[model samples]
Target chain A: MSTGGHKGATAAGRLSVLVGALSVPAFVGLWELIARSRIVNAVLFPPPSTVAVAVLDWIQSGQFFGDLSASLFRVTVGFLIGTAGGIMLGVLTGRFRLVSSLLSPLFHILRPIPPIAFVPIVILWFGLSETGKLFLVVWGVFFTVWLATHIGVQKVDRGLVRAALMLGTPRRQMLSEIILLGALPYIVVGLRTAVSISFYTLVAAELAGAFAGIVYRIEIAQQNMQTGQVMGGLAALGLLSFVADRSFAAIAERAVWWR
Target chain B: MVAMMHNPLRPTPPLRLVDAPPEPSSTAPEAIIRVENLSIVFDVPRGEVIAVDRVSLAVMPGEFVSLVGPSGCGKSTLLNAMAGLERPFEGEVIVAGKPMLAPRPDIGMVFQQPHLFPWKSVRRNIAHGPRALGKSKTEALRIADDLIEMIGLTKFASAYPHTLSGGMQQRVAIARALANQPRELLMDEPFGALDAQTRAVMQDNLLELRDRINATIVFVTHDIDEAILLSDRVLIMSAGPGRILRDLSVGLPRPRSSAILTDPAYLALKRDCLDLIRTEGRKAFEQMEAVT
Candidate 1:
């Protein structure tokens, strides 16, 4: 009797797995059928087949690579520069009273203002230039990484510091090794959050004005009323960001290596 | 290895005991660690509270001393003052004839928790002190290897602290402190966190380790057996506003082991310590009642 019940449960589990695997494909198949059935406007609500064709066309146009590289460059370079500045300043402000007193209030005040809100000022400063877009992304990523690093440094175990002091660790090595590694777990958490923030700010940046970028192409496709291309662009953006986040998570897991 | 077979993770065997050091003559005039009327104060919201109250003691070189007291008796604060980890509100702490304003490389301390760097392996953790003192990587690792062999953790030298048991981690911590080869070692209840069985083993291990090293040691613990078994002299301290109540010399024979616990002379010394602590504890209790 128990074996019968166990077999029944296993069958149910396998069925659920099968259904889950078909979920996305089933949704696409239904959409394709409905679009061809002429129940709704196919031009505006393009089917999966139309979307796929549009994506293929985009790849063939050679502009896809340009747009992808532009977008990738902005996010990577901006994230790197912003994260570096944030961690450096975070260590300074987090570790030293004088630096914290001088910068913390200003950072706290600015951090709450959304990166999107900087669009107008960014436009005024560097009209239609790549610098303006890069500025927006860096601005979005900087505060988050800075705040994380700052809090991480502050929350480092006081016992570890005391032990290091008793061990006669020099002031420089204390900060670079003991304090940095002690607070690394927290910093990695902050960096992961900034990865998403970088993408969020990228939207505002390209939409603000850009010659080439995935979001810029989305805006252009929208203007031309090519809904299939616009949907294709959206799909590409989602996949790119998802990959970035997952890869970052893997790196973070290794970052705290001891764990 | 034979005794530890019950636990597969514990590959360490009982270490071979080293010959005990020749007893230092009591008449040695110069003290290695001197606390002259030292007092340490902490500020609570209510007001200032004294932790160490005008305590004075002198430890001659190569002596093994224990500070015995109940919990919160400021024994650790007193030890910290000697280590230069705490500031004195009055009087002075002098080590090796130099006034201790800051922690010097010549003095080492082991806290209750191992506080090993989680990222570093046991070898690296032990090497940290020497590395911090500006020793090269190879030289530091050489020192760590020797200490690892001495502590009987050669199998787990590359293991991180988390992988090791409480006793093993504490052993690593001791080796780390000894890496710098300090002139004096201050330990604040180093084995207090271990289990009874592990604590016994650690106490025996420390006794053997002490026999080989020449550093003067000042250990703080609330365990009476631990104090009597380990110290050449035990200084008993009173509760709150901590003061040394009595100083009893442990006259047990050298090359001692847990076997000494049953000796009539050891029991007599322990009884005297218990009597002093019991009377002081009752007085402290009454004093609390009177204040309330």
Candidate 2:
């Protein structure tokens, strides 16, 4: 009786795995069929085949590489700069009451205003340049990383701090080692959230004005009424963000290496 | 033999005098730690609460002393004052003839929880103290390696704190505390979190370790048996708003082991400690009930 139950459970597990594998492909096949049929307007909601063709043409046109690199550069460089600034300021505010008193109130007020809302003012200040686009992404990423680091630093174990103190650890070493490492798990969590926020703000930035980017191409395609290219651009953006999040998740797992 | 004398199956004769007579006052000048009318208070929402109440004691150099009391009795608070982790509301703690206002490299402490650096391996965690004192990496690691071997954790030197068992992690904490070779070692219920079997084993390990280190030791615990087993002198503390009730010196022979637990002299000493604590515990309980 137990053997039969075990066999039944294994069969169910295998069936679930098979179903999960087919889930995305099945959805795509159904969408293709529905588009090919007269059920929806193919021009507006182009079939998967049309979208695939457009993506292939994009790659052949060689503009795709330029567009991809531009978008990648904005996200990567902006994320790095924002993360560095956030961590630095966060450590300062988190560790020192004087620093926190001076900055935390201002950050709290500015933090509530969405980075997307800054697009208009950013355009005024930097005027459709790469700097303007970079500002928006940095603005979006900074607050998340900062808040996470601030809270993380504050929540560091008092016991660890006491233990370090009793061991004769100096003030500087205490912050750099015990306090910083203790709060790292929280900082990594903040960094992961910032990854997605960087992409979201990239949309707002590129929409504001951009000479070249994935979102820029999508806007140009929309103007020309090339629905297939527009869909392709959306797909490319989704794939890029998905890859970024997954890779970061992998990196984050190792970031708290002790666990 | 000695093991036979400690056998539970046999009824051993009670020794007439288990307690040692008070030592001469001339030893005071050589005292490693001197707590003079020390008190600590905590401000709760309603009002301030006294944790330590004018507690005064002296521990001579190379002495192993235990502060034994019930939970919330502020025994740990008193020990913290000695470690410079707690400030006295009045009076002060003087170690090595100097007042302790901040933690110094000459003093080390092991808390109830190991508080080992989760990110660092056993070796690196032990090496932290030396490195923080500006020792070179090579010298610090060498110190760490020697201490790891002493703690019998050489096999797991590179393993992180979370990967080790609770007992193993605590052993590493002891090694880390010893890394700086402090003149004094303060342990606040270091084995309080371990299970009975592990606690017993750790007690034995500490007994063996004590003979080898030259530092004066101040330990804290609520367990009467633990206090008597490891300490040269056990200072029994009264419940809340803690004050020392009795200072009992254990004269039981060392090279002590768990076997001494059943010895007649040891049992007599433990009984006296238990009776005093029981009376104090009852009094504290009644006082709380009256207030409520």
- Best-fitting candidate, scored by DockQ: 1
The local distance difference test score of each candidate is 0.90, 0.91
> What is candidate 2's CA lDDT for residue B220?
98
Best by lDDT: 2
Q: Model 2 clash pairs?
A: none
Candidate 1's TM-score: 0.92
Query: B133, model 2: CA deviation in Å?
Result: 1.0
Tens-digit lDDT string for candidate 2 (B245-289):
999999998889888889999999999999999999998999899
Q: Interface-residue RMSD per candidate?
A: 1.0, 0.8
| TM-score per model over all chains | 0.92, 0.92
Tens digits of per-residue lDDT for model 1, A91-118: 9899999999999999999999999999
As for candidate 1, its interface RMSD to one decimal place is 1.0
Per-residue accuracy of model 2 over A47-118 as CA lDDT, tens digit each: 899999999999999989999999999999999999989988888899999999999999999998999999
Please, what are the lDDT tens digits per residue for candidate 1 over residues B1-292?
0110133453444455786443222333477887767788999998998998988788988999999987878999999888778888887887877778788878988999999999999999999999999999999999999999999999999898899999999999999899999889999999999999999999999999998888999999999999999999999999878999898899899889999999999999999999989987888788789989
Residue A153 lDDT in model 2?
95
